[model samples]
Target: MNKTDLLKSIIERLEIDLDMIQRAAQTAYETATAEENIAENKYDTLSLEASYLATGQARRMEEIRQACKAYQQLTMRDYDPERGIQISNLVQLEDAQGNQQLLFLGPEAAGLQIGTGPSKVTVITPRSPLGQQLLGKFEGDEITLVLGNGRQVQEVVSAW
Candidate 1:
């Protein structure tokens, strides 16, 4: 999988999310200001609830905008095996049971999955527990993951 293509996909997804949020925010704002929604009494809070929804939507929109900016400004580069894994690297890991997982280390938007089937890659941020264990780890290195009450071990199969 090409890193450039992956980054492009991420940016595109973020843009789509931003567009949806903008529309929702606009609708919420309209609902909040509509004459029909105006509070008729202390017990009637339709307008107030709409306003709160609008505010939350606005905050979400700003977050998506910032995420877009972050992804756009992200620098994509080839990983050096000798230097170990880092952000922008696509890593493949194999668990003790031989199940392989593909992960893309990114600066943000963790848990976003791109592509499908074997070509699929899950975005992970350095702050994530598994991501923290993978940082600076080279191919063939073993990393342990704590899941619920069980511990699983995985080996770095490849990274680039």
Candidate 2:
């Protein structure tokens, strides 16, 4: 898969999310400031709750904005096998059962899956457990990944 195309796809997904969050924030703000939502007594908290939701939505919007900026400013480069895997590297891993998984190491937006079926690629951040294990690993290297209560070993089939 082309890294440039993947980056563009990620940015497009983020932009959609940002738009949704913006709309939700606007609705929450309106609800919070509406006259009908005004608290009439100590027991009334609808306005307060709406205000809190609006604040949370706003914070999420800012986070997505920052993530978009980070991804936009990210420099895409080919991974040097001698130096091991690093961010922006597209890695393919295979399990003992012959199951294959494609992962794109990104600066942010972990858990975002692009595409479908066998072509699907999941984005993982350096801070993620699997991402941490994948770093500094070379092709054909066995990596032990911790999954919930179990551990699975997979080999790095390729990186580029």
Candidate 3:
């Protein structure tokens, strides 16, 4: 799997999500301002509820827009294994059974997953536990990951 192509795919997916979020935010704002949503009775809070919902949706839309920008600005360059792990690097990890998972170190979009088949990759941030452990690590190095009640060893098969 090509790292640059996968990064482009993730950016494209984020763009699609941003468009959907914008539409939803606009619809929510319109509904909140519609006359039908006004509080007609003493016990009613329809307008207030709608306003809150619209505000939350608008905030989410802004967040997604910013995330799109961040992803777009990412430099799709190959990482030198000698330089160690860093953001914008794609790391391939192998477990005891030889199972592999591709992870992309990103500035944001920590939980986003992109691609399919062997190209599938998950975005991780430096703040994440696994990401923290992988930073400054080199290929052929092994690290023990503690997750909840279990521990597993993962080897840095490659990074680029």
- The model with the greatest lDDT is 2
Candidate 3 global CA lDDT score? 0.86
**Model 2 TM-score on a 0 to 1 scale:** 0.96
Quick one: RMSD of model 2?
A: 1.0
RMSD for all candidates, in order, please. 1.2, 1.0, 1.6
Model 1 scores worst on lDDT over the 10 consecutive residues at 75-84
Model 2: number of clashes?
A: 0
Cα-based lDDT at residue 93, candidate 2: 96
- Please report, in order, the local distance difference test score of every candidate based on alpha carbons: 0.92, 0.94, 0.86
lDDT of 1 at 76: 88
In angstroms, give how far residue 83 of model 1 lies from its true place.
Answer: 2.0
Q: Per-residue lDDT for 75-151 in model 2, tens only?
A: 99898978899999999999999999999999998998999999899999999989999999999999997778999
Work out the TM-score per prediction.
0.94, 0.96, 0.90
lDDT of 3 by residue, 32-123 (tens): 88888787887887777767888998888888788789888887767776679898899999999999999999888788999778878999
Task: Quote the lDDT for 3 in model 1.
Answer: 93
